[model samples]
Target: MISLEQKHHSLLQEAKRRTQPDIANLRLCFELLALTAAIDRDCAVRLAPHNLSEGKFVVLFLLHGQPHGLSPHELADRAGVTRPTITGLLDGLERDGFLARHSNLQDRRKVSIRLSEKGDATARTLFADHTQWIGTLFGGFSSEERIQFSALLQRVWRNTDAGKMASPAIAGET
Candidate 1:
């Protein structure tokens, strides 16, 4: 029996020939998607033994930048998550003793969050380890290739118009 990978390869080959309007850009999109998934999978594997997810890692990483602490609103904006999503992340972090939430002195309505001692150590270690891993992963690429890919990705990012587009699922509702 043909393996799943074989089947996927066949499908992509067929798609290249038969896709509607013969858009060549789909190949680039697929390549980008596969590259993205591989990077995400590798990162997830590296963080797995520590019981860390990308979201948690991002929170810790962001907290490290603002040692004085960040407000939930600030985190939401920076993390590109909804305020409620940040609340969920904070709840887990607080429960894990990775961070603490304190009432903001400047605004009674807002709360500030900062890493605990344990959180700081974990974040720092993970950041260093992951930085090394990232460097190793990209070591094969020459400086020119890296620069070209970065520019290409920036163009694709702008093409998405993500900042201006509404969530696809909710677009009709609004």
Candidate 2:
């Protein structure tokens, strides 16, 4: 039986030999990454005037969704980042008066991070403008196409996870 590494190498060679490297698959990956970067950069640019970074904006946005707040670990899990990274982002947000950390009443040892009024306002303003861009990006797809695309992407995610092809969290990000 051929080794997995050998099979992978063969597949790589086959991919390279293709005329356009499987247009649909290649374009899917390229477009997803490009779009993510573009969105991130645009958000960063908008946040810059307020002295906020992309990561910080993301943290604020996530927290804004759950006004009740989330623990650092929970926030990290939702944000697809390390706890330490979330910690730094939260630190910046807190320092800027965008959020506050409160000890969980049930578990004093656990800390919950909540957005301040300023953070709420910022999140609303940013997302309100961002939604226009999001709508434009997906406007070309019909409703049925959007549904089908989402289903197909979910199947791909499940297959990748079941096969242990990549981190499930990372797959979900795509």
Candidate 3:
């Protein structure tokens, strides 16, 4: 079986033969996607022992410190997910005793989610370790290199905004 790097090189060579485009930019995009997949896999492995999906972890991390808690809609918005998705995550988290839902004092119909004691403890422990894990991912970089990389990544991120996307005709050209 071919390695990923070998496959990537083969794909790039085929692309170069078929199109008159910036092969270097296309290679960078491919590399970025591979990096993202690797990072995601690493995250899943790290969270597995704690029985937390990234979505569940996001909800718990968001609700960690606030005694007042946030509404389901608020969590969906903060998590950048749809209402149904957040509801599913909330269901699992609540079922597992990671969170509790309380009705609002004035509006009994409205519900807010708060971290349970177990959830709080888990979040605290995960936060510390997670921070270190994330930092370690960048440990190979010097401070200045990290700063420059962050700036470059921010520039790339800005271009990824939906409103900034090129139209289909132009996008298809390259």
Candidate 4:
């Protein structure tokens, strides 16, 4: 079987022949995608046994220290997801008895979310495990290297022009 790196090299070679693409940029992008996919896969595996999706786990993690809980909108913002997505996660969590929604005393329209007893326990365990897992990912790097790597990643993140690109949908797809 061809290794992933070898496959990427073959694909890049084909790309060069077909379009004469910028090899460095394309390789970097491919590497980033591969890294993201690996992290996502690992996270999914880790969360599976606990019956949590990454989004649900993230919500639980964010709610850990909030004594007064968070509004669904606030959770959405902090989680960097849309309100509807957060609502769906919230619905699932609530159904699973992992979280509680409380109405504000002064305003019936306002609802705050907090973890159920079970959620608190699960979050604590997951948080510690998550911290350890994250550390291990960067364990080979020195402190200075980690800082420099973080800075470089932030720079790459800020340099995106993707927001201006047109969607890849066919004209009649919508």
Candidate 5:
């Protein structure tokens, strides 16, 4: 595994060699990418035992909170995936009896996605475990440190114009 120090050293060298403008900002972005990758891996590890993937878990988590269900387009927007990709994710969940697809009476072409009874229970169980895992993961940080870290991350998100651009579909996200 590449440690943060090694990553920083490599990025610093690249920046110096290229004489990159905004070296400090570039370095900060690299570090943040590394940190994000680490967190994503951890989340995946925690979700795997529950037979959940990051994408699936995110979909279910969103569905769990909305009893009325969400349209596929809405799920695509909220889950940060393309519409076809959302279909595949929802397909497996539905096949396993974790979700349901409802056609709009007014427009048969329109469909809403919802968690089924089994899916809801399964997701709830996984969520409890995942929540505990997250708590443990961040346990090293004191309350103040956690606050500061969250603030820093939020600032980075704002600085990066995260989701500020048009929808990923419009942006040609695949």
Candidate 6:
């Protein structure tokens, strides 16, 4: 009775032998991971002047377009981080006057987060031409290539648990 780990190792070895796995698949995987890391680093650098980290900026971005304020748990879900992490981000934002937290009037037990006036202004300043920044990253790709790439990315995303983790509801929260 082979263990699961042993079976997986056997399969991987077989794949490497049969495919000579140092080819397109492996190279593409490495390139994609490197590109993602570079993008994240660039975003962090661009946001540093505003005293915001990438995670905090993501929370602000999500709240920017929504009329309904999000609870910390909801923000955590959308940001794909733990509730405690979101709490820390919210605390820092609140202290910096970028956002405010209020107890839900109808349910005093729940706390909702909303952007302060300062936060709104800061977001506007920081996000100017943000879409153009993203466009620059893919500028070399043709329109058809962009569509195909996007569809491929969507397929990969859907096949992973990462997509499920970003659902509107809090993870493991009733």
**Candidate 4 global CA lDDT score:** 0.86
Number of backbone-clashing residue pairs for each candidate, in the order shown: 0, 0, 0, 0, 0, 0
Q: After superposition, how far is residue 43 of candidate 5 from its true place, in Å?
A: 1.5
Off by over 4 Å in 2: 1-35, 65-67, 104-108, 148-174
Using lDDT as the yardstick, the better of models 3 and 6 is 3
- What would the TM-score be for candidate 6 when compared with the true structure? 0.68
**Which residue window of length 10 is worst by lDDT in model 1?**
1-10
Write down the TM-score of every candidate: 0.75, 0.62, 0.82, 0.80, 0.68, 0.68
Model 2: per-residue Cα lDDT over 63-111, one tens digit each: 8878689999999998999989998999889999999999977989989
lDDT by residue (tens digit), candidate 5, 78-145: 99999899989898788878899989899999888999998898888888988888788788899899
Candidate 4 off by > 4 Å: 1-11, 19-21, 162-174
Better of 2 and 5 by lDDT: 5
Q: So what's the TM-score on candidate 3?
A: 0.82
lDDT of 3: 0.86
lDDT of 3 at 103: 92
TM-score of 4: 0.80
Q: What ordering of candidates by TM-score runs from best to worst?
A: 3, 4, 1, 6, 5, 2
Compare the candidates by TM-score and give the number of the best one.
Answer: 3
Residue 35 in model 3: shift from native, Å? Answer: 0.8
The root-mean-square deviation over C-alpha atoms between each candidate and the true structure, in angstroms, is: 6.6, 8.1, 5.6, 7.4, 6.0, 8.9
* Minimal lDDT window, size 10, model 5: 165-174
For residue 88, give model 2's deviation from the true position in Å.
0.4
Error in Å for residue 173 of model 6: 26
User: After TM-score superposition, what is the CA distance of residue 91 in candidate 1 from its true location, in Å?
Assistant: 0.8
